[model samples]
Target: MTETPSREHRPEPLWAQAAELISEQITRDGLTPGSRLPTERDLCARFGISRVTLRKALGHLLDRGLVTSSHGRGWFVATPSTVREWPNDLESFTTTARRKGLVARSEVLEQLVRPATLDEADALAVPAGTPLLVLERVRFLGDVRMALDHAVLPAALAPGLADVDFTAASLFEELTARGVVLDRSETAIESRIAGEALAAKLHLSAGEPILLLDQTIYDADNRPILLSTVEYSGDRYRLRTTFRPR
Candidate 1:
């Protein structure tokens, strides 16, 4: 009688297996930020994988923001402390920074009264030619510039808003003092790569990743009062929120 053939066990995908092995090695080695990873040749030899597979694993790490690559240098671990938790709240950037014991300040870049753009008009539910007060400011944490904020609102809704010293005060607080009661806000977050002007303003290299927050603030009466587009340096901030079961 012929003996039954033994079944073969398939292994995991090479790239995925390599990624897992590298991650384990990173943990076991206690590799700190800026620590250079083993050369690709060594890693390939150790993992019994090809160069392409090793690169795929490294690419996976890079996509997760766990590693970074220099032009001529190999991949290095990213700094964990560089990441900050940002909650999904309606608090002003100034207030959030202050709560964290960091000095927060703003530099007024542009302030003008102009006609609303088509997008702005739609967002504020105003006519295309409606007058709007636009304020652009750069936010700083201590000496490091962290974010750029562009805000627009109906000029008629906040009379004499142009007279306020926005660089020295919180826009939210100023609006509150002006009788604008903000009850809630809707926000959309996205990722983008910095362009020339934005890169210079944020002190980052061109094409660096950044976080964009487009939000609309509403009053207690559910009237939209303000539209803001804020860009934050990605390496310096992380969005975090808690989820609870209903």
Candidate 2:
């Protein structure tokens, strides 16, 4: 006798099935942004799934940036915002920004080879006075100008990058296309007033508050690939995180 495949052999989870159904509904109904979703009980009954399974599916939508839940209210479809959050296994800035429905645009202000300053050498873990490739850019979210990113790459690595259009794409993304393996990143964030040049790029008045992020992206072998500093305008940006104690 031939035996049927076990339930464990199913290709997708209950939540995944539920997520697809809800996703299809959203698409079919042409639900505009900020539209409220159905109740959990309604969803469970509609999909013929258990409450537990239905919730699992809702979780998938939340992870996909498609929906959000509230305490008093139920789930609602998300509207695009300038809020930036890091994704799990985030590999590129352009990819991350685009996922949030923001157009990732940049303008290269400076691209040249220069000797690393004492601080730059310390941050990059290279010899003092080592030559480094520097690319300065202003990053925009949609039509709103957001941040000025100053990126420094080691001279010991790809020296041919000076000719690339940094404004057209991200350096990290371009490096990956060249078969470079970037494993992880170290990021530090703080807030400060914008300098004169930064103010002009972000169209900010003097002494305005700004969020400053310093990021170091490393390769698979824990070698530092790029050092970057990003400055964010005050009114147009915010950062979110979920923390767990060690």
Candidate 3:
């Protein structure tokens, strides 16, 4: 007697297939991270899917952390990967993440434009009472917490910097667009015991090891323009740099 065997391989949902193809297209086009993708209507037309199906596909990509949507700016590629090698030359965490093929996302912990105090002014070599933009964020690689970064710069340096969405914006890009020349950066790194407060934010236990990085960025004129501190979670990431002797 011949009995029909039940089908063992099931077809993927149309939306899931669409999502896969869209992700492939992102790589095939060599799209840069943070670059906007085609509009939803255009994507649907290209993929031969309806708007509803397209939305589902996009949602799937969003869930996979491959794309982000701006209020009116359409979808942006979030292509990035892990960070293990550190560039000896100056670099931004955002750039490092992209170069290392890891998605970099940030949770804005603080963003303020306020008058600089005497200490802040002295650190940045700016006049006291000058408007300074303060930014703090918990940087992440995919779902893993990586570092807590704090930065202060003259508010006028980037006119609308305070309004940028730090979660998706890169400070270096903003500074460059504003014609701010980053000539050099002086940096120092040390190991420290994480305090209860920092641990709470970084998901580490009190007294855990953390790498503290202090840096000051200077302009082409050799004037200090920005001061930054980044505390990297020791368990999650290690800092490395190449050394060469002439």
Provide the overall lDDT of each model, using Cα atoms, as 2-decimal numbers. 0.80, 0.74, 0.80
Predicted candidate 3 versus true structure: per-residue lDDT over 1-246, tens digit per residue: 111111244377767777888888889998765567989877877777778988998888976767756444578775332354466777888887887777788999999999999999998888899999999999877775778999999998879999999997889878998999998999998999899899888766778788898999999999999999999865444556666898
TM-score of each: 0.67, 0.63, 0.65
Runs off by more than 4 Å, candidate 1 = 1-83
Model 2 lDDT at residue 243: 82
For residues 22-66, what per-residue lDDT tens digits would candidate 1 score against the true structure?
A: 877789998865578988888888877779988998898877777
lDDT minimum window of 10 residues, candidate 1: 1-10
Model 2 clash pairs are 15-57
- Model 2, span 78-143: residue lDDT tens: 544434455555456688777776668888899999899998888878998899999888886655
Please tell me which model should have the higher TM-score, number 1 or number 2: 1
Those runs of model 2 whose alpha carbons end farther than 4 Å from true positions after fitting are 1-89
In model 1, which residue pairs have backbone atoms overlapping below 3 Å? Answer: none
TM-score, cand. 1: 0.67
Model 1 RMSD in Å is 9.9
- Candidate 3 backbone collisions, by pair: 80-101, 80-102, 80-103, 81-101, 81-102, 81-103
Model 1, global lDDT = 0.80
The candidate 3 region of ten consecutive residues with least summed lDDT is 1-10
